[model samples]
Target: MRSLILVTASCSLLAACGNPAEEADDPIVAETPVAPTNAVDGMAGTYEVVMADGTVVSQTLRADGTYSDVAEGEVVETGSWRADGSRLCYDPEGDEPEQCFAGGQIAADGSFQTRDDQGNVVSTVRRIGDENMTTEPTA
Candidate 1:
């Protein structure tokens, strides 16, 4: 009788197991997003920033991933930069944290707005220099 009770309990436990077919039908899967390449080329130039307090600042973004942020003809910050889609991410040196700007709208007259990560317009940064390096003909 003891042997029969032990065998019955083992059979009950075995019956409680999940079905293999059900597990196979409901398999869990995860997917990751892919980032675009060569998205940073469009923003490689100098930008002029007129602050809310009426102070003008110059931010130069180079293609070699380095940037120089100048204020009042003095270099205030130097850092590295990258682009994710239309957004530009800056990683400044020292204790300053990284910030991202997006939603840029450039016009034919070489003017554009630089927006923050929340898609809000932080500053209207103008394109300072000639984007195309063309020399005038000398007579």
Candidate 2:
């Protein structure tokens, strides 16, 4: 009986050690966005993003403050965005993330562009009301 009790106690201890319920998983959480300092945020109020080539693209800024990317004649991509310090940052497609305020571009019309230091526009984001702009911070 003593040996059986010891074995049971050891088994229970081992089972507890190996159990996966120790901690819960963290759900996807988005940070709050910072208001634009200049006219950038104000200008960002629901404007179409015009490429450097002058091709006007359609995107919507939702009342919920999310951003979306619209490919020509394709479906829209919804995303989330927020402020990291003073820089504007966001994640896209609920996947890879980006930021514009940190070195990001708030277009003349309140649209956000993620650009490289060389001024190459890597991504252009328009607020889609429900989706927010995505931000990728560069070095």
Candidate 3:
């Protein structure tokens, strides 16, 4: 009886150890990492800015902190930009003071609006492309 019990236990252990399908079915998968959330990450791209006066201009926000505004195929303005939470601030190339705008939550259609202090819409910005500025390598 003891020999019979030992043989049954040994067969059970071997059967469990030899089953490759059970191990394959329950794989040890590594967890995928989550990306950090930042407002500037979404803002780095080309956009079409429509002012409240119905004037339209093309703006490009580079990932390297520089930006340019093009109007009528001419570079009208060049600036450096930064974001503080949801607020976006721009410092133009000249002696002009820094201009900061609030409300930068981009919409599903790649559109967002900048608002003034009194909750007025300053401009409507729509993303036109996904091309971001990249710096060239130095030798």
lDDT of 2 by residue, 1-139 (tens): 1111111112211221221232223222123334346322332323344444455444443334454444465444555444343344444554454534323433344345444335565434443322244231223
lDDT of 3 by residue, 58-81 (tens): 666766777767666767677777
Off by over 4 Å in 3: 1-39, 104-108, 133-139
Whichever of 2 and 3 has more TM-score, that candidate is 3
Q: What is the lDDT, from 0 to 100, of the residue 80 in candidate 3?
A: 75
Model 2 — which ten-residue stretch has the worst lDDT? 1-10
lDDT of 1 by residue, 52-109 (tens): 4456666666667766666756676677776644456677777666666553444444
| Steric clash count of candidate 1 | 0
Q: Considering TM-score, which of the candidate structures 1 and 3 is the better prediction for this target?
A: 3
Q: Predictions ranked by TM-score, top down?
A: 3, 1, 2
Best by lDDT: 3
Q: lDDT, candidate 3, residue 57?
A: 69
Q: Alpha-carbon error at 36 in model 2, in Å?
A: 8.0
Name the TM-score of candidate 2: 0.37
TM-score of each: 0.59, 0.37, 0.64
